[model samples]
Target: MRLSRYFLPILRETPKEAEIVSHRLMLRAGLVRQQAAGIYSWLPLGQRVLSRIERIVREEQDRAGAVEILMPTIQPADLWRESGRYDDYGKEMLRIVDRHERDMLYGPTNEEMVTEIFRSYVSSYKALPLNLYHIQWKFRDEVRPRFGVMRGREFLMKDAYSFDIDEAAARISYNKMFVAYLRTFARMGLTAIPMRAETGPIGGDLSHEFLVLAETGESGVYCHKDVLDQPVPGEGFDYSGDLDAAIAPWTAYYAATEDVHDQERFEREVPEDKRLHTRGIEVGQVFYFGTKYSAPMKATVAGPDGVERPVHSGSYGVGVSRLAGAIIEASHDDDGIIWPDSVAPFAVGLINLKPVDEATSAAAEGIYERLTKAGIDVLYDDVDNRAGAKFATMDLIGLPWQVIVGPKGIASGEVEIKRRATGERETLTIDAAINRLVAG
Candidate 1:
């Protein structure tokens, strides 16, 4: 992608409505544009990062044995009524009516709908331990939606539902999601701490919320300091094996959000030096609600003994869109966002300091083609913009690697390579630069 032909509408000044750094930076960087109070239209650059995050979430879900299936954005209100939550869900639910006066709604969550789907064709225990997931947009009518996408009324989410025959099997499903969440956040260069959380309207006794610590977070959290430095399971971890032992290291610590906090117990358990109290953003939540929706909606399966039983179920959710803002909150500096390598919209950014110059343009064009053919997402800055403006835009968008081609450098038969995170720049021959980027 070349900046000369791209649609990056970077703001020269910060917007007054943006209250926090992440919100401001997102607007200044031209990643998202607000269409309404809390609804946004993702631009080209922002959409690329969003897609990358979605892919990571999907891959991790698949590794945990969850199958992918897309659900609709709009749903009939009868499904919510069947689950006994039509009125109980309150004003947060976006209730509507069709032309014929039938109750409809833009779904805030999919528990009732997923339960209805599960009971439709899955009748025998042979289909037990099934997990289904979807990446889709959801709507919730927040009374005060602010902080950009971090607390948007309309946002994208990756929600998964697991069905099992009994409580014991449901626990296994929960553990799979627990491990999957850890790996998913780790891929985005975040250390998310899993803490006991209130069930809220979701309604379940067993629930955990994964939070990423940030100075400007919405909720306060308390945990052990070791959790910040704990090692996440690596790529080769066997998802099929028993994850109980793998997760023990993380669960050994006492962690809780404000809703579930026990100050006295925290004081007794954690030493002063080991205690860590900070503000955190909730990025994911998992709930194992035994027969919560299944029984009410008649989502039953036949047991081995030939008895019909309500399948124990669990729901796992990751804030796919909110994570982009949360990540910026955790990783940005004074300049702009510092994207993680795995979730960077483009792997490499090639800047042509002198787009009109024959030598500089040729060098940048060659590098861009080489990087693209090598399977790297490269953004070439071929726009007729000043060097400072080009640098600022590239930093604001936060590509991991940047290659600068200027007349002076090209005259020496070399280009400058800079790492966005560390600001380390090195001058290398054109051949050597291409080799290094391809190898990475």
Candidate 2:
């Protein structure tokens, strides 16, 4: 993509309303624009990153044996009523009325609706252990929606619903999602610590929230430091095997959010040196709600003994849009968002330092074409802007690498390659630079 023809609206100054680092950086980088309190219009740049994050989520969910199926943003109010939560969900639920005067709502979550779908067609244990998921927009009218997308009124989410015949099978489904979440966050360059959490309105005895530690986080967390270093389950991990063993290393450490934190137990379980108490942002959560919604909504399947019973169920959710903001919070520096390689909108930013100079423009275009042809995403800044402004813009957007092509470098038969995470620069021949990035 050429910046000259792009739609980025980079802000010159930080917005006063942005209280957190991610919100401020997101505004300045022109990733998103607020249309109302907590409501945002994801601009082109933001959309790219959002799509990348959603793709990673989908990949992991599929790897864990969950099938994809999109659900509607608006739902019938009667579905929630059937689950006995129509009124109990409170003010956050955006209640609506249709032209026919029938009750409707912009769904905050999909438990009730998914249960209705399950009971409609799935009748017997033959379809047991089924998991369905979707990536879709959701809304909850927050009383005080702030901190940009972190606590937005409207956001994108990846929600997966798992159905099994009994408690034991439901636990297996839950464990699959647990391992999936760990791998998902790790792929995006985040070390997410899974901590025991309150099920809240979801009403589950078994629940875990995956949090990424950040000073500006909404909740305080206590965990063993080793939880941060535990390796994620690799790609070849057997999903059909005992997933408990795969997650044992992470669960061995005591971790809990403030809602469930036990100070005395934390101290007893972890040595002083191994204890880590800090603020953290929640990125995802998994729950085994048993028959919470299924029984109430009559979502039953026949057992092997021919007895009809409510199917045990679980819900797994990842804050798809909130993760963009969370990633910024966890990865940025003073400059701007330091996007992880997997979730970066572009792998490389090609800056034509002297867009007006024929040599520099030609060199940049050449490198951009080569990278793009090699199936790399590259953003070429071919606009007629000052070198400092170009550099600032590149750093603010935070692509993993910046390939600088100035007249001086071109004259010397070399180009400058700079790593965004570290301010390390290497001057190499154009061919060498291209080879290095391609090989990476």
Candidate 3:
């Protein structure tokens, strides 16, 4: 994407309303625009990042054996009534009524709706272990929504529902999602620790929240410091094999959010030197709420001996859009967001230091074409902006690699290569620069 043709409405100065670094950088980088108090219109750059994040979530979900199926954002209230959460869900639920006086709502979560759908067609133990997932927008009426997309009222979410015939089978399904979340976050360059969490309105005794530690996080968390460095189960993990072995160490660790924290136990179990009390951002959550929604909503399947039984169910969630801000909070420096290559808006930024100069433009254009042809996403600075402004824009957007093309360098048949994260620069021949970036 060329800067001149792109709709990058970058702000020259920071917006006063943005309190956090991600919020400020997002505004200054022209990634998003506030449509209302907590609602945002994702601009070209933000949309691209969001799509990349969604794709990772989708791929991981598929690898974990979950089939994809999109659900409606607006759901009938009858499903909620069946699950008895219609009145219990409280003010965060956006309840509504359509013409003819029928009640509806913009779903905050999809437990009841998914249960209703599962019961409609699935009816046998043979199809017992089924998982359905969707990536969609959810609305919650946060009375005071702030911190940009991090705590937005309307945001994107990747929610997956698993249905099994009984407890043993359901537990296996739960573990699959547990490992999948680890892989998903790892692929995005995040180390997410799974901590036992309060299930809130989801109403599940078995629940775990995946947290990414950041100083500016909303929840206070406590855990062993070494938990941060534990290795996640690799891609070769057998989903159908014993998943308990894979989840055992992660589950046995001493970790909990503020709502479930036990100070006395923490003092007893963890050594003083190894204890870590910190703030955390909840990026993902999984729940095994046996018969909670299924029984109430009549999501039953026939047993092998021809008996009708409520299917045990579980729900998994990853905060798709909030992750963008959370990632920046955990990874950014003074300049701007330092995006993980997997979720970066563009892999390489092609900066022509002298955009108006013929030689620089030609060299930058040639490199951009070569990179694009090699299936790389490159943001070319083809606009007639000052050298400092171009460099600032490239750093602010935080592409992983930057290729600098100037008249002097082009005259010598060389271009500069810079890694955004390390701030390391290298001068190389034009061919060498193209080869390095394309190979990368």
Pairs of colliding residues, candidate 3? none
lDDT of 2 by residue, 13-45 (tens): 999999999999999999999999999999999
Model 2 clashing residue pairs (backbone): none
Give the least accurate 10-residue stretch of model 1, judged by summed lDDT.
Answer: 224-233
TM-score of each: 0.98, 0.98, 0.99
Model 1 segments more than 4 A misplaced: none
How many residue pairs in model 3 have overlapping backbones? 0
Pairs that clash in candidate 1: none
Worst 10 residues of 3 by lDDT: 244-253
Worst lDDT 10-window in candidate 2: 355-364
Model 3 lDDT tens row, 262-338: 99999998899999999998899999999999997888999999999999999999999999888888778888878
- Tens digits of per-residue lDDT, candidate 1, 336-382, equal 98999888889998999998899889888888988899999988889
Q: In every candidate, how many clashes are there?
A: 0, 0, 0
Model 1 TM-score (2 dp): 0.98
